[model samples]
Target: MTQKVLVTSIFLHAGGEVDHLLRAEGFEPTYAPALTKRTEDELIGLLDGVSGAIIANEPFTDRVLAAAPDLKVISRTGVGFDSIDVAAATQRGVVVCNTPNVNRYAVAEWTLAMMLGCARHAVKNWTEMNAGGFKRFEGTELYGKTLGLAGLGGIGKEVARRAHAFGMTLLAVEEYQDQAFAAQYGVTYVDLETALEQSDFLSLHLPLNAQTRHLINAERLARMKPSACLINTARGGVVDTVALAQALREGTIAAAALDVFEEEPLPADSHLHALENLLMSPHVGGVTTEARQMSGVRAAENLILALKGQAPASPVNPEVIPTARYAVSAT
Candidate 1:
């Protein structure tokens, strides 16, 4: 007689809604044993009787959905639902939702930090200092530098707002460019070429779609100012890793910082390891403690609502939600 929630991703903390929902007044829940491609297969097995689920960035392939006929809702841990086949889920009458607006600050702050770190050679300096040596390092100051933001969505706007406080000139590229929005951010709307040519620092905030895949390839990298630094907190494949490495080797640009890569868990033999001017972090732009807890708790709230026969605020496919089993009952 008890309802269960299945978690398909590894969480930073276990005490969030996973624990809360399971031990709460009238709910039962279970977290997937581990997070791996194999775990996803196991999740499909566990999901047979589960009413709801909380998942991470792994691909929820159509095969997985075919196994969960009783599923009522899916709560994505982050803002992106691209990994999940939303159309397939919708056709199967499953409600899919995500936790939005939770990780914007974490990612925005990390993007700016990477920009500064690359400019100042922070990682290289630390490496030398830890090796017990005195070293001289040259670095550029951010004030009055031009920054080109490739996307002007929530995360991009936050980066722009903070960059303004540092007196940085901002140029942005958005498919949905609005002069009014640009004015509010104190940014000028520019074409990609213009922004690349003039920017001292380039930060990407776009998603990985057909038009954006390998967006920063050899030709585009060639357009950047020789002294410019590139920062990407957006999805991998947005910048071509091989092209970037070539640019760094030839000093086509000053330096590059990336929180995401063309491949996740960047391969052990990856050439990026040999680039002195490259600053890298494990695709953790949004992996702060606050973001983790917020994602978990927010996912739980949305899942709970859907399970209780109510509408969730951030359903990926709103139309599907209305026709889903739980939504029909709630309505």
Candidate 2:
């Protein structure tokens, strides 16, 4: 008998490849219709006897999991698996996987672009210029600025490389020590306080876990130089959106560029929308054609390997495999 699979949170480009790949693995994959709160209901409807799911940013709460009792695996589209209740999935013996480092270059480039945007007040000047007013917008130069990176991982290293090439001083802080990596990148390892205080442009590239949720609160925001600009390309909750809005409104910092928000599809009433000095993107730092296809293909490869009872290259919750049985046909 052929196993059944469901794919949810429709990604336009990757949908075709995901369907084809699952079919090649001898599983019949039924894609849930376009993303919506009601899409959850659609997934439940299609998941009646489904064995696996290739999930995106849709909410996979305990209720959703309970509705699909036979679900054996969930392959997440990105590195962050916070959308799914991992504990509930573990209890149900569901294996969840994510593709990391696939979007490192794309996200890092976007982060640097945001930093440059903030420094030059690019959007503001462009808006003013188009309005037919010769606005004298004096922009800050990046050639001699200090760049602070919150987490010195793959994305952070790429940011450091680009920033260095632009003649900026790099300071990085990580939870665990890695002096060798810092030395190779010419990154000065510093404490969070010093990095936040000294940086002309502070960038964040960390996950949103318990320790990192709202890592940039009012207090941390207060530590930054008044002329400094803040950039966050990582998970949204990693920085407090409210505090960031307040900081931008009160001119606590010169400017800010946010790619992600604590809430997806940030509300129209959000204050950040009205702020002139704030630059916002709809969480598209890693949405380039190359990154999207790479992430999709990498995730597909991982799913195929996991189904074949082979170790996945990027298993987010490897422990779940202990309780779950690998798909039989994959072998």
Candidate 3:
């Protein structure tokens, strides 16, 4: 019997040779509906007999995992797996893996674009220009500015590399102890308080976890320089959207550009909608065509390797491989 693999990521199987890869492995690939995420019940229904899955930011809670006894492996298209319950998956001997560094350049470019947008008032300028009004707001340049990075992972490193070319001084608040990277990029590691107080632009690149949930709130927003800008191309849950709205309304910071939100497809009544100093994108920072092709193929490869009882390249819970529901083994 050909094993079944469920694919929920919208970016996959469209342009990439994902189907060819899966079929070559003798695995039958089944795609879920479009990008609209499925509820827990819907997910369980889709995963009925699936032995492997390639998922997006869909909810795969413990209940859903328990309901799907045959599920052996989950390959996430992106680096962040906060949406999945890794602990529960590990406990049940289900291997979880993610494609890291696949879309690093795309996200890094988007982050740099957001920073430039905030500095040059891209949103307001475009809005005004389309309205048949001529209003040229004074803009600032990125040159010789201080950029504080909240996390220095793959994406952050790319951002730092790009920022260095533009003559930006880098300050990072990171747990990644890569002294070589720091020395090469001239990144000054600092505490959160110092980074916030001194940075001209504070960019976020952290995962959404217990300690990182709403890491930026009213108090921290108030700590930034009045002329500073905030950029978040990372997880939405890292910043408090309500507090961010109020901060923009009251000019707590000069401006902000956000690609992710606490709520996807931001509600119509969201206070963020009324802010003039805010720029927003619909979480497209890592969804470029090139990125989609690379990440999709990488995710498919992860699933295929795990299903073959071999170690995946980017296993989130490698400890489970020895006993991963008979789908994968440490090799």
lDDT of 3 by residue, 153-195 (tens): 9999999999999999999999866899999999999999999
Instruction: Please write out the lDDT profile of model 1 over residues 1-331, one tens digit for every residue.
Output: 6776777657723566557654573566776644444545765778877778888866666888888877888888888776788888888878899987799999999988998898788877888899998795888889999999999988998999889988899999998876776787689999999999999999999988778999999999999999999999988789999999999999999899999887666888998999988899988899988998888888888888887777888888789755556642321
> What are the lDDT figures for the candidates, one per model?
0.83, 0.82, 0.89
How high a TM-score does candidate 3 get?
0.96
How close to the true structure is residue 115 of candidate 1, measured as C-alpha lDDT?
85
> What CA root-mean-square deviation does each model show from the true structure?
2.5, 2.1, 2.2
Sort all candidates by lDDT, best to worst: 3, 1, 2
- After aligning candidate 1 to the native by TM-score, how far in Å is the CA of 26 from where it should be? 3.2
Best candidate according to TM-score: 3
Global Cα lDDT for candidate 2 = 0.82
Which pairs of residues have clashing backbones in candidate 3?
none
Off by over 4 Å in 3: 14-16, 328-331
Please provide TM-scores, in order, for all candidate models, with all chains considered together.
Answer: 0.91, 0.93, 0.96
